[model samples]
Target: MSDKSKTQDEDLPYYDHPTGGWGSVKSLAKIIARSRPDPGIMQTLWRQNKPGGHMCTSCAWAKPDKPHTFEFCENGAKATAWDLTSHRCTPDFFAEHSVEALKSWSAHDLEMAGRLTHPMRYDADSDHYIETTWEEAFEGIAAELKQLDPKSVVFYTSGRAALETSYLWALFARLYGHNNLPDSSNMCHETTSVGLKKVIGSPVGTCKLEDFNECDMIMFFGQNTGSNSPRFLHTLQAAARRGCHIVTFNPVRERGLIGFANPQSPMQMLTSSRTKISEHYLQVKPGGDIAVLAGLCKRVLELEEEKNGGVLDKAFIEEHTTGFEAFAQSMQQTSWADIEQASGLKRTDLEIIAGMYANAKKTIGIYGMGLTQHVHGFVNLAMYVNLLLMKGHIGRFGAGISPVRGHSNVQGQRTVGISEKPELVPLDKLAEMFDFEPPRDEGRTTVEVVRGVLDGSVKAFLSLGGNFARAIPDQGQADPAWKDLTLNVQIATKLNRSHLLVGRKTWLLPCLVRSEEDMQATGPQAVSMEDSLSNIYGSVGKRKPAGEHVKSEMAIVAGLAKATLKPNPKVKWDDWLGDYSLVRDLIEETYPDDFKDFNARMFEPGGFYRGNPARERQWKTESGKAEFTAPKVLTALGELPGEGQYTMITLRSNDQFNTTVYGYTDRLRGLEGSRYIVLINPKEMADAGLSEGQMVTLESAVDDGVERRVADLKVTAYDLPDGCVATYYPEANPLVPLEYHDQESKTPAYKGVPVRIVA
Candidate 1:
């Protein structure tokens, strides 16, 4: 590590100070300095928050027609302010700096310079990036792509890309004979889709925001609602006020879950009167979620047998589900002693939760990456469904499952077909809609793509938005693998860490921001997004374009497609680029039943809701019922590190999103301006003969060889369960091996890793 890296590590303590005002001021300064946008420009952009403009790109929960006076959140303001930055990367700037020099700069510093003004090409001999014309850049990319095998090319999509852009990219990849779509979904919620599909026959949740108000009891498992999804705080507050019982189960006592002041409410904000959130909080050990869920279900089953003539939904199970007998037998086989030990919760606690469930007429379960980023993440989701099935929570007005997605358009991308292994039906339908036979072979996922690049199977990487290298685990392996790629193209509005990990030939193409107006040959364009509730809504940008030269993502994809693909009389790339509604029309044709009147419905204020099978208690399985799947118990359950070692979980701070670091401040943890401190129980600290704020190193107990040791980290005593510790993500992601992912979902096991603490 360099002196700068060492200094940053050493400054962790200062960042963790609990002084709120100073921290907020420091964060504001950081945001302004790092974004490097003119204050005047940002003020002008901020004024564009009119009635007809779309909601901020960071969060999709904003209500339309609401006054712009209270429209933005802290993160949303930062995102928009950053977009309005006046900095620009001219050809002279690139010519002055070598790729090696730029690579040395921090991720934030590179992006602070502003957006790419024109197309650029990497010069290998000079190790610098020089400006190039759009025609030359397209021609070079097309010539190289035509020589390589279609399978060798990887098309990566980020969450920031608009729906129209995503569809065009998918269309181009399919028309060019490739299905290699390694997207943002692969890193986040692939587990939710994979697990839900097997049991509910749909990859989406059935619950809407309205369901939160109607539920009698709400159980939040393995999710940090306050930090991961702040908008959920409003729902939680409303439910609490309505006398609904709310329970939170996680390793950390998240502040947002405890209570929150509605920033939008003038009275609440001015008076500082906060609404209490959780009635009960259970801090369970990391990776112990499966045991906790199973225990609750077991207790519910026992209660059902005693009072409700067996707690199982006999009618629903028999009529719509399969494999009940096997699943019940497995539950019967699980001993209470094992469950108590693994979950670190008493038997009475389980009964209390179960009693609440049994008495409630309806309940809604909400989860985030915490539950899905585990080794048995898919199984964890299945267990959640199993609990719902036992009580017949599906097909009801107030009861269902909701998985809070991270990005605005992530679900939209999946809806428009950005999958590595797209189903045959969709491929066949696309072939009929576009007059081209889509590739039937399976493509590479995120991890698989990295591995392919390492082994020389993949040649190119075309990313639409995210910083993949930083977001993915196993950076030690990925950094070298990234250098081996033949071409790396990023279509983004700003710079990020992934841009530094350049390939043999790299290109950075500037694109319009989501909040910016997208004008093409056709006219003004409108994009669509699918929310967590499976509701598809139209988003129209009313703000002017950030830069005159910047193009919408759709136009960029179209240009690339026209340049690379073999000439086909049937496909009209230019026509689709001219009008995005035509792309929606094609999407409607491909998925006729779901997207009828694609253009007409989108004109409605809130857009349309997609089909959800669980809402009607309809299971699309072969047996016309939901299926019960019992996971096999691994023999490694009882095993632990020799001594003085416990499981470690990675989490996000209240001030930051995935890789986009707005600032280093975690107000909920009482840690301000810091991203590198470990939270440990005071008892655990004393048991290890350590004091608060003692420097310690964490060593991975797993044999995956991924290790991260931070010296002199402030050990703030927290109310976490025994044998469990917590730290922030990306910083702690290095401790998780790429192979330590859920088998069924292929999502990284970020929440659970065995580790030892040392001085």
Candidate 2:
């Protein structure tokens, strides 16, 4: 760490202004200046979220049918500028920095070094990456893969992969006779899938983009809309303009939820005026979402007793949902004292929130990682569904659940059959189309893959995109295990720390990003992605490829498939490589209901909605109806932090998206120049005898005896709940044990790790 990275307690600036507006605009400009200026960034911005434009490569917020001239947000612009920058990480650059030295560089420095220009292999002797031919790389990877058992290799996919690439990647895995497909969702929103599936019969959110407009109330559960999904702020601002109640339940009162000034709005930009959001904001504990939700439900049930039949939606419950009686009985038995202790909110506050929900004719419940990245994330989601079901929110116009997904197409990748559980996919249909028997046995997830590698069971690993080492929890264990792998391959646009985790035969294959033109033998091609709201849209990059050697993710997958698998007459890899439409046709054949006319739909105004069964009231569960779940416990973690320990909430800065850090400044949180600081409540800091700007080490409180700690982190006092602290993710991920995760979903409990600060 440099001296410039050090912080002074008195020098910390408190941001009194609203989020977005000029601040967001200035931040984007700063990033553009820091990164080599790209002249075409504005042109690319104009096309983003438009009919024929590329999807914003950041958040999965749905694109509107009739979009604005600039549909991207400040964070979206940063992503674009970051991708489109002229800086290149060519072989010459690699010759200068050794792999070991590069490992010590900050994540932002590594990414800013720029896009990889050619295929390269890690030379163990020289400790540097040397250029390698694509053919040699493919042949080497294929040879190793052929030697290893399919079950011993893991194919990791990132959410950045479009549906076209993901479908082909999944097909490639199936053709190779394995289902070891662990993806980004396993580290984030797997709970949303498992929990929502059992409750609403759909793994995805039930709401559409238009729901925000017609909904009477928008309730946010642990979503930092401003930084994570800046585009969603426009919807919230519009809803606020219509007098719709905007409520928030999170440990931190994020700037986005407090107020927003849309950069695209001329009046607001000119006057520096902002729209106030979060009509009601409650600061709940880090892992207290489930308890808070239960409290809301309990208050609603009590209101029903007071008002008799008027409070409960008896018609919707009896007609479209089941298990309501059990859910209501459980809520009736919930104690106020228990709820208050678990959540840091008072009973009166919860009652007020319940009154708002009951009075609203229609409501939309939106949540993010805060609710889904915990030990009891699955139960928390189930409880959230119960709250919505009590008032008949699902399947109704403008009333449903929305999980604000990170990554551009994380949901799309899952929808295209990237799952460890093969039963979730249409294996029979795939077998019929590809002339091969698809693997039906369950495979490994992200955490399982980490354990597999550590135990020497997983010999080879491949990633379509994403920084596997940095993104996954327990990096202390997983990082060192990468060297034990027989082969490691990465298909990415830029260089990340994960690329440095070289194995015996490691290969770094460069691929074109969504902002680059994907030129195939046939013509320029467009890949499709499904947003958080199930909106499928085509993204065609207007800029030239970063390098002539950079191939599209689809082409890379096809090449690998051709190299590894024998010629299958039914599956035409060569033809699909030339024309992606052929791949879409095969996808349509496999998923007839969802992707019927998939190619043609790419030309639609904003593409099309994939259509959620729950939205139409067509439940696909065993009961054939939306079912309410009675949570066994109300707390998210089912335990309290021990004395001298606090629940550590992992977070992302304004300049970050997932593991990709564009810069260190988190302007929204009044943080700058560094990402190594921790936020603690002032009262708690005093209780611990810790001064602001004091360097401390955070050690995991788990009894695993495998000490996990991050040292040299400066502590700063902020407005957080007692016994809770916050730190940047990836940096703080080591404190979260790989085994400590949601039991049902296997999603790491990144947001709620118990740790103690040592001075």
Candidate 3:
């Protein structure tokens, strides 16, 4: 840890103003100045999130049917500037910095160096990357891939991939005879998909952009809107002004939930007036969401009895749901003492929130990674869904559950069948279309892939666009395992730490980012992205390609498929590359009900919503009704923190998105210059014999620990629940063991890891 001055201590001045306003404007200006992006950056910014322009590459919040002239937010601009940066990591730069030397660079510095300009191949002897032609690169990759068993290969997709690219990737995987298609969703929202699909018959959220307008009450669980989804702040601010009840449950009192000042509001910015969000804020303990939700359901049941059958929609419940009697009995049996202890909240506080929920005719529950990155993440989601079901809150105009996804097109990737589970995709339909028998066995997920790599079971790994090694849990164990792979392929727009984790034969393939125009034989092309809501939009880049050598992601996958797969009469990889609409046609054919008129509907203004059957009261579950789950355990950790230990909740800073560190400063939390400091409750710090600015190490308290620890972390005091600590992610990722994850979904317990701070 650095000195007090360098550490950006807790004593630093707090950001008292609202989330947006001048703070956002200045931050965007600084990023643009620092990146010195291409001349077309201004035009690109103007077109972003508009009807016919490129999608914002940050969060997947839905764009309104009538979007603003400028729909991009501060972080969205940062993502765009990141992609459009003038700095180029050309062949000469790679020649100067050896792979070993680049490995030492900070995550932010590695990306800030610039966009990759050409295809490169790793020179194992020299430990440097040398420029290579795309032809040679694909040929080498194809030759090695042909030798490997399909089950040994993992096709990893990042949220950066568009619907077109993701569909092609899945097609290539199945056509080549494997189902090992793990994606970024495995790390974040896999729990949502697993939990919701079992209960609601749909993996996606039910709410649309219009729902926000009509929703009477909105409850946010562990979602930070300001940093993660800034554009959505406009919607929140409007809801607040309309007098909608906004409740929040989180470990930290995030600035986004407290209040927001829309940067786009001229009068609000001029007067410095802010829309106060969160009518009520509850600081729940880490891994306590299930308990809190159960408590609310219990209270709602109590209110229902008090009101004599007026509180719950009994008719809807009886007709549209199953297992209510058992679920209600489980809630009734739940003791308040247990709920209070697990949630770190009072009975009165929960009752008050429950009262508000009962009064609201329609409600929407929004959440993010905080709720999904836990051991009981599946149950956490199920419990939330149960609460909505109790009141018939779903399948209506303004009522449903929304899991705010991170990445732009993560949901889109999965929608296009980028899943590891063979059962999730329409394998039979795909086989009929492509004339190849697809693999029926379940394949490796993100964590399974890591284990496979380490055990020498996985020989080839192809990443469509993510920092896989860094994003996954237990980097200490997973990072070096990449070298054991026979081949590693990264298709990206820029350099990151994951690119440096070279295998026996590695290839860095540069591709066109979302901001850059993608042209093919069919003329200028547009790719589609599905938002957190099920709405799909066609996005066409306004700017030219970063480099002439760079190709579209779809094109890259097509080339790889042509080179790797034996010639098949039915699958024309090149023809699909020439016209992405052809890919959409096949996708529509694969999932006819969801993607009817896919090509035409995708280009519509604000795209089109692929309506979820669950939202229309059509449950696709086994019983043909919304199924209720009665979890044996009511908490994510299954227990509260023991003495001498605190639950650590890993999070992202305002400056960073996911594992991509744009800068070290977390201005939203009133900290800058460093992200290595952990925020602990002041009393907890005192109890642990630690003071502000003190250097400490956090050791995992798990019994199966193989010395999992993060050393030299500076401790800072903050307002958090007792026995609960907070730290930035990727840095804190090591403390979470790979085996410690949701039992059902396999999503790593990143939000609730038991750790003790050592001075």
Which structure is stronger by lDDT: 1 or 2?
Answer: 2
- Give residue 465's error in model 2 in angstroms: 1.0
Write one digit per residue (lDDT tens) for candidate 2, span 199-283: 8899999998888889999999989998999888888889999999999999887889888888888988898788888888888
On TM-score, the stronger of 1 and 2 is 2
lDDT of 3 by residue, 1-759 (tens): 111123233554457778888998988888888889998888988988888889988999888878787888999999999889988989999999999999888998999889888999999999999999999999999999999998899899899899988998998998887889989899999999998898999998889888899999999998989899999899998999999999999988788888788888889888888888888888898888888999999999999999888999998899999999999999999999999988989999999999999999999999988888888888888899999999899898899999999999999999889998888898888888988888899989888998898899999999999899888988888887889889999999889989999999999999998988888998999889999998899999868787889988988999899999999899988799898899899889988887999988886777798889988999999899998888678788833578898898997988898888888668887788777888887767777888888888998888784888888888878778888888888899988888888888899889999888888
The global Cα lDDT (0 to 1) of model 2 is: 0.88
lDDT for each residue of candidate 1 in 147-254, tens digit (9 for 90 to 100): 888899999988777667787888888888789987877877889878888798888788866677699999888777766666567677778999999988887767
Task: Give the clashing pairs for model 3.
Answer: none
Comparing 1 and 3 by TM-score, which wins?
3
Q: Give the count of colliding residue pairs in each prediction.
A: 2, 0, 0
**Given candidate 2, what's the lDDT at residue 262?**
81
Candidate 3 stretches greater than 4 Å from native: 1-13
TM-scores for all candidates: the values are 0.91, 0.98, 0.98
